[model samples]
Target: MKNITKLPPVVACCVVIATVLWLPESASLYAQQSTAAACLTTSRHQLSKSGKQIFDIAQKRLNAYLASTKTNRTNAPDEPVHTIPVVVHILEPEGRSLLTDFQVHEGIAELNKAFRNQLPESDGVDTGIQFQLAVRTPDCSATTGINRVYPNNPNYTLYGVTSAGGPGLPYDQVYPMSYWNNLEYYNIWVVNFMDQGAALAAYPTGAYSPFDGTMITASYFTTKILPHELGHALFLGHTFARAIGGGDLDLIECPQNSNCAEQGDYICDTEPVNQSSNYICFSNANPPNPCNNNAPYGTVLKNYMGYNTFGCQTQFTNDQRTRMRGALESLRTGLINSKGLDPVVTGQTIPQGISATLTATGCSGQIQWYDAPADGNHLGSGNSLTTPVLYESTTYYASCLRADCPSDARVAGLVTVGPGLPVHLVRFGAQVTEPNTVTLNWATSFETMHDYFDVESARDAKTFGKAGRVSAPFRVTSGISEYRFADTPEPPADIIYYRLKQVDTDGSYSYSKMVSVRMQEMQKITIGPNPAGNSISIAGVSRNWDIEVIDARGMIVQRLKNRFQIDSERLPAGLYVIRVNMENGHTVARKIIKSQ
Candidate 1:
């Protein structure tokens, strides 16, 4: 992280004064009376500019598509033929631990469920819609595919893209941002993401492609991150941005009201919401309340796009449907009405037990099954056949051969033997000690033979880097295991987040819930003789602790190893974080002002 240079002396003074004046009476009084002060900062400009531009371009494309179609209907066309071609890029240092085929399939399933209102489980809302999977092409080609690439760069964290020049530069020397070129394919890069405030973000409508533009981030790869980013891909912004100022405050979870006031989310359909403080159950703590003198506003925390617990979020509004369709028409023409690429059949054969409807085309005299128990002696003229055998707990494989293409037999997709287990993050004790190190412990339930774990940390919640890894002990059945790791070089100020990654042997992976720790503030100890020329004595309530002196700009100036007295002959005056590593696993941090 780069330090923000201070403004000119006069400018700095003005900013300080302005900041003080802008503080409310309560905050101002607290700052004066309280031992420590909290400051409020804004990143509206830093993070959103790029997103805004991408959205504008997507919006224009959508508008153009709508104008050309001129279709007159109230709702999005039913099961309208749209097949978006997507390419999933797995970016990781140890590429083998990236998402697996099953995980990717699950993610795709979730994507389809959200896109079409076919999710069996809805968040108590009725969205009369359905999104059907487009039939495979005669080429047996799929619109979506996953690709894995290893940067082998240590600098690439588990989150966010790395810049060209930095400590972590060598790992991603040839960064992905530079190689992105295909605009037609929805390019989703699943790498380690970091930053502090947001889980995911997409620019200009959040859509990314091989050509034109791209939106890359790791947060969107897990949970419902893909759907949320896809929403941006289709032209949706944060539901709760202020009408006058372009920023979202609360629009996803609050009480519902019929005020007709355009305050919440700016979209009339979505209910007003409060900020998310915890990730637990879905039912909103605060119900809908009236706003702008309109009807009461209700909470939409359960909406898939809202910042609710993954387990709770599940639906999309009708308005959102319109927005998505509009985007498809305008910016994603490749997604709509793609058929005949693969043929689908529906039939039953004696042994295969409900055979997968085959999609092969001309050039074959008849389809034959080799080594197929019941179908071994049977032959078919059509592309597919259904068997009566039910093998739910067993793996199955099949291939299709054609006379036109001699060496062109297609292998069927891999089918799992049994239901897969749901991966979750489990945390242990939450205590800190000295040397600025925190012992992190965790466990996983519902394990598989190939599963493993990775520990990650972040300075800002938006960006994260791998800290360590723990191979998951295999489980004969569903079970759990406890593991621990330590975070070194603890930061003096700011909160830090830690999380777990469960990886399967086949490379599929899932993320556990995130945990955060705030360093305790030490304000009681005083160790200065104002503008001390040579020596200073650390005197206050006694506590055996080590102290490290840093400059005003967060640079370490000197370290006093367990000593209460220090000679300051070689030091200049400044500000720094006085860090105290406790004997336990926790740490305490305080700001120190030094003058010479």
Candidate 2:
């Protein structure tokens, strides 16, 4: 599947509003009100006062764990330590609809970076915490280490956890959390998670239902959701709450409110801001609310622990550091100190240019490759062996083998090469221009074993029936390479999507993001050459509507209310949206065709 990009902020806002409008009345009310005493509301999944009490009990237990650590230095090292083992379970359609190996590694890198304050400067926030990836242990230990599993049923259910199944697929559910034995590792299920507006949601760390484990909605084929959910898996709660009585803060409530003072996310430091707020950089004008104090209502929008923009959110608070440490010390010990992770996987490495040509055979499962010494970065994954290079020297490559159950398990491998090598193909790009020909291009940092490239086009992006094939240049002088192919029989004049399929000598095949292109005759609307040009008649109306002529700046030029004929000899040719405001408060808008 292609990586999903975030919708524009304006578009996202509209989606959110539209979603709310379609929600059930009960759900809407539940999202609006906040109660001091936990009260089960329709929209919120948490129990009312009873649920709050249970959460309080858990909090006390966690607090006690922290207190014990403070008093006894038994397991405490000389320096503050933070480690977490994360497992990603990708649930997809029956025909192996999982994400690429690089996408998975990208997700992991994002998670560790956010936790360790090592994210790219582009992410914006700079938390002071340093998180280190746990080393893989010998004996192929199977604790709470990272594990990816696929189920048979398209739509499976496990108690409270239900897969929101995508279109044309059945929902998958997991029953009895006991089915999963790696309780010690943080279990994160990435699947089709979406609500009305496709907004992402995750349970706070340590929060879990008896029947269902922690499930996070995968926004695209990326790891943004994982880090966000990991935060919840680490015990962070929503930044906004509902207000009850005369309280100054909002508690954890769904449908976030705009009020900042009344909703307390339980974190004393996070400003008591309302829901639906955007991430604003920290400034003297907007200082951090150390205690959620009413007089000082500034916000910490840059904090990763808060609900901020994925790009803008970069840091975790000191309080979050303390809490996460405490949680790791108590409940997540096995996950934090797992023996299966290799230290080489977590540490930084000087990226070497493409060098090695690793091959896989009889590997009926999914294969994943990652860049080593580069923080477990993913390169590519498939049945075949391929090399992918990174621009930065701090990139490492690792790969995992995945397969269908009831069949023999697949074996995966990981290898690293030296710097200055050609970059490998991680993704492909293509655009279909003509019926019989397609334009193809691929993206890769390093190229060592890249045998050839195949150009595939299809009527539907979901499935490519294979239209044409092209051979990739054997020797790539530079870090990047591009190729093209023309199919013998031109595709029909219709919408066609194209993708590049990169193959290795070992027969493993990786795919690139699909590009959509359409070939159609532009419908032309002719206006006048009639009546000696005294007055021109408009023709070719797609729908019934009155037309108005507007200038380039949208100022009304002429209104054609009742007459379709206009004196156009004095008017110049231009473009405009012939808008028809219907009596039903709906508008039928179309582009207008005009003649000079």
Candidate 3:
């Protein structure tokens, strides 16, 4: 960050000697503060005498729209949740993964929680905007939303948009090669710069600018940093963006009239104030403004658009939401139609009794399955999926994940399981019991008319006979009803077959696909070839299993759900335990010895 002496004479603000960390000798003037504050004050147009133009135009558009009707703007759909795709580009030297996959994923997750106002620390308005990691790049290839680049020159650096094409011209070349579709995806460049400490953002007017996006130093890649810069990307100026040249600019500059909307920050809700040091969050009792007789600027200093100490920002004002969403409809309308965020896939239609395997083409990464399009534990990964025997058609959500960055949107991919059944059989399985004994498990959802399940058994796959009956739980209108039946055949047999006879309350009945079982076969978990080489085949587990491979030190080396095999080539030569967990809450483990 730049030193105090380098600041322009007209851009005078007191300097706070409050930093405890070391700032690079060549950092930007924006990076003078400690890590707790983002360089939110460093937009290209922010220091311009005419920097507030984005806000000025936004206000007139807002008034004109509010005057028109109660309807949502024609460009944006108000009811359905909107998703803004984000792509993180981490540029660093070779041999270093500066931003780990987990860090990027966690940051994106927190970014959404902040925008949705769901974070525990969030006391601000939910912007009604959801930021998702992009599943596809500009050229339509799958990605983890996190992209890494290694320049031939180890000492490469990128300045903010203000310096994109200047000096060495690294930003100009790097951005065009690294950025996803700007309109479809929000690009955030993460790097370590010789002269930058925190971050800077581009306004919507530059949505198509060659360097259109936010750039932040790696040290400040915290949860709130991106959100604050993105607030500028959506056209929000700093809460202290405007100040008077020392005159009675009271009611005219603050929350007093419509003129205030045309004044400070161009949002009347944010109290107008003169610029203060990067530190000290005003209590509003002592206004940051000095020209208006120290008027009380009633506000929460923790606004995301403020330069207060980091970890202190928690909210966006109501007018801030309007300005942002309004920009989405007007100035930044291109983002609304960007297809970069779509996590679409090729679905499948299978006959009754089989499972469907969906594929997200062009993904050179793991594919994840979700029960819903948003907010839920992932059902499994790799192969896109492995569902239990489906008696009824079912739909699921799928996204390609590279580096833990999922196509983080709630895009649905249909997977038809069966021809069609009245009641949805969400789960169906059989586990071996004592010797030849077997326990059957089945679950159904949305069964308001279901009656009971008649357990049927047979010596072979075809021609079944009744073994027992399990009464249905009181028909739950909106939940799943599970049933279990244990069959103990006379004498210990080698193998047994089982299926469900689902009889409805109305006397209609359907027969589930026959599931055959062998004695002690399904109970055993196997990992081989014992002293394995490249990959290990995990045999004997069904589709509902979750696996965790732990090294001898008890550290989890690999984890994934519902897969028959795992790539063990990368695992260091050592002894490891493969623990298999079933959906019925049953768990078993087996030891594997990897050879050098």
TM-scores for every candidate against the unseen true structure? 0.42, 0.41, 0.49
The candidate maximizing lDDT is 3
Model 1 segments more than 4 A misplaced: 1-61, 64-71, 74-77, 123-144, 157-160, 163-166, 169-182, 196-220, 243-246, 249-267, 272-286, 290-294, 337-596
Candidate 3: lDDT of 254?
A: 32
On residues 433-510, what C-alpha lDDT tens digit does candidate 3 reach at each position?
Answer: 334457677877666566788888875344578888887754545577667777777755545667788777778777
Task: Sort the candidates on TM-score, descending order.
Answer: 3, 1, 2
Q: Return whichever of 1 and 3 wins on lDDT.
A: 3
lDDT per residue as tens, model 2, 45-155:
221344344445656767788766542222211223444445555665356545655676676767667765576743322222233322232234334333445555534
Error of 1 at 505 (Å): 56
- On TM-score, the stronger of 1 and 3 is 3
Candidate 1 per-residue lDDT over residues 105-190, each given as its tens digit: 77767777776656666643223222222223324454335666777665564433433333443222323533332323455555
Best by TM-score: 3
State the displacement of the C-alpha of residue 46, model 2, in Å, after optimal TM-score superposition.
Answer: 5.6
Q: Model 3 off-target regions past 4 Å?
A: 1-79, 157-170, 194-197, 246-258, 282-297, 343-596
Supply candidate 2's per-residue lDDT for 140: 45
